[model samples]
Target: MSMIGLVDCNSFYVSCERVFQPRLCGVPVGVMSNNDGCVIALSNELKALGIKMGTPAFTLQPLVRSGQIHLLSSNYELYGDMSQRVQAVLEEFSPTVEPYSIDEMFVRFDGFAHAPLLEHARQLHHKVRRFTGIPVCVGVAPTRTLAKLANRAAKKIPAYQGVCILHAGSAETRNLLQKTELGDVWGVGRRLVERLALMGIKSAWDLAQANPKEIRRRFSVTLERTAQELRGVPCIEMIDLDEARQRIMTSRSFGKLTDDLDEIREATRQYGQRSAEKLRRQNGLAKAVLVFLKTNPHRQDLSQYSPSLVLELPRPTADSREILHAAGLALERIYRKGYLYQKGGVMLLDLIGADRQQLSLLDTPQSDAERQRSQKLMDVMDTLNRRMGRDTVKLGMPTPGAAWHLRCAHRSDRSTTRWDELPKVRAL
Candidate 1:
């Protein structure tokens, strides 16, 4: 009954990098993953250079040395903050908003007229660009599937100016669907594409015209729903509740290998802290915690070794203290006397909301006051660190000089936020 709009940012990671450093404008820059392993984000210029995604940095050494491709380590904090800003801007448009991913969102607009939809979309685009400097493409349609298709078209079509609307039962919309490729449609994976090709359903319009009953019998309920949604039948409803995460894992490769138990414990503590933060943000609690340490899996000449231990909590909690305690105990049990460990991580499982957790009568239960106190403390810590920059007040467990710091050779100074690292610009 309502129109769905899918708003997606273009080159999200690259755009985040450009936000802080305006000098990088029009440059072929890329953000690399941990260990400077590979290019995870590429600017439009770099994409034109024929550098494909997942290409290892070692292979791109020539381009780097030639000054053709600028590279920097991943700045997740900046990207995350920018994502929050974008979502906040989106919330101003619609009452119901679903943050689909780091760079995508879905909004439901019920009362907006067809003529004004373009104006509303244009205003949203201008506001986002003016405020955050991130360009976005918007797609509007009667259903989510068509919305995604319209989004792709919005990005591809120059006349739309980064906004496309596919109205239900419109001749123009039907013609666009007929011309659209099936692979571009949401929920149509490679296997489904092959099967659909066999059935002569090459385009979105063809799939929409196919008998829903036959499609359901041959493929799956998901494909049938996709077909139905394509034909203007709203089989998929907008999800208001946030999707629960199936598993929460925190792991990182070390800058250098070590066999020190204290280093391992420190790494485990940081991982647990990160996992706990994620759990709390998702409104979930973990009942099972796993700690694992491993050596480089690729090194064949050395004796390969890895060990892990799982601990079941007395009760599920999103508290960092509880998760850190469980993780510490697991690390103590799993860490061997002599094993070269390169990385360690914490995994939280069996997640549920704290209010829904079943409590034990015999075990010590956290009172409402204690729960509120813990939440307040965590919230304060999160706010302070986010406002003042990360690691402003880190736990003592994160030992210094464990050799797990990212290889950020070209790190930008926190000139605007940090008191000590102010930037120096010389005047001529």
Candidate 2:
């Protein structure tokens, strides 16, 4: 029997913060999304306080002011750095480590015996915590679907002690699945849960016992695969972690609404540059650029206008200059003069591998030397931003007090990335 283990970090974003601020470990802590808009991550204590995920900061002001709950702005740089540290620790334990998300990894323990497999999982849980200060639960089972369930069991069941291993066709596995709700199963959405419930498949075990072909006939091939996976048959193919994205989007809500064209233009330009950087990192080129502006839909009193435009690039390129120029033109076409904009974004669409771009018959052929120079310039800019901080080598100066800047007043320091922001320890 093959053994696959899932390693999932506990309250990942909140845990990342706790590593730097130990005082927050026992307190109710929540992490807010961009512009301090809404709660995105929460600790167990915060959940117990009845502060649900996606609750706006303004709604939780009373709890915050009373010092009953602490909400910090999402510091992605710290969380991403911490996630990499956890992954680095996992690589030491398994030959095949597939990152399922920033906080979840699937590892193969194919050759291990049952007893040794359990022991190895415990060691992994300990090592990740010890090395990265991020607590993780490990679930080992016959298939990836079962592995995910096992990991959840390790988290929710106190008896598991943060590690759960289930073999194929085990009585214990069936018992656990019976207790698991249909909605809790991986890949089962709310609508699917309703449909499955109507068909008397109310729990994970019920779905596992379902006929795979019947499920496919009634629903989709994807749901059929889920059923197969539930039966300890490996059907879902693991995606390569480094696979290139088909499209890249960079967007965020502004600090405040503004009708100033220059402010929106600057935001669009920044978004385009960021999207281009992502394209270069993945070694992909964008054939089209999309620029969009959105108004506050919740503000019924204000005049609303949301518009977007897509412009094809003259040539498939990952060059930020070309991308930004196209974005500016697109913005000019879609942007209205009177409406207040709350959010703006840029998307790089119709992406292809940088080396796989097809030449058009009427396209002016660029020299190899010119392409190399453009690539080199972007490389230098990216390197400088990495070595220094972001925006160290951008195309234009940002306007001071720009309304489009994110309103992250409670964001923690970027301790892992910026030199000056590193945490300081005092001798007591």
Indicate which candidate wins on TM-score.
2
Residue-level lDDT tens digits of model 1 in 1-428:
47899999999988877777787889898878877888888888998889888889888888889987788788666677788889889889888778888999998888788878878888887888888889899999989999998899899889999999888889978988999888888989888889899989999999999999999999899999999999877788766557778789999998787888887788888888888878888878898999988898887766678988889986778888888999989988888876687888999998998678775675444565676787788888777876776667656646556676556666555444566765567999
Q: TM-score for candidate 1, please give it.
A: 0.89
Error of 2 at 159 (Å): 1.9
**Candidate 1 runs further than 4 Å off:** 238-247, 282-285, 314-316, 356-383, 397-401, 411-428
Question: What residue pairs clash in candidate 2, if any at all?
Answer: none
Please give the CA lDDT of all the candidate structures: 0.84, 0.91
Please, what are the lDDT tens digits per residue for candidate 2 over residues 85-183?
998998999888998999999988878888888888899999999998999999998888999999999999999999999987889988988998989
* C-alpha root-mean-square deviation, candidate 1: 2.9
Q: TM-score for all predictions?
A: 0.89, 0.95
Residue 261 in model 2: shift from native, Å? 1.8
| lDDT at residue 424 of model 1 (Cα atoms) | 66
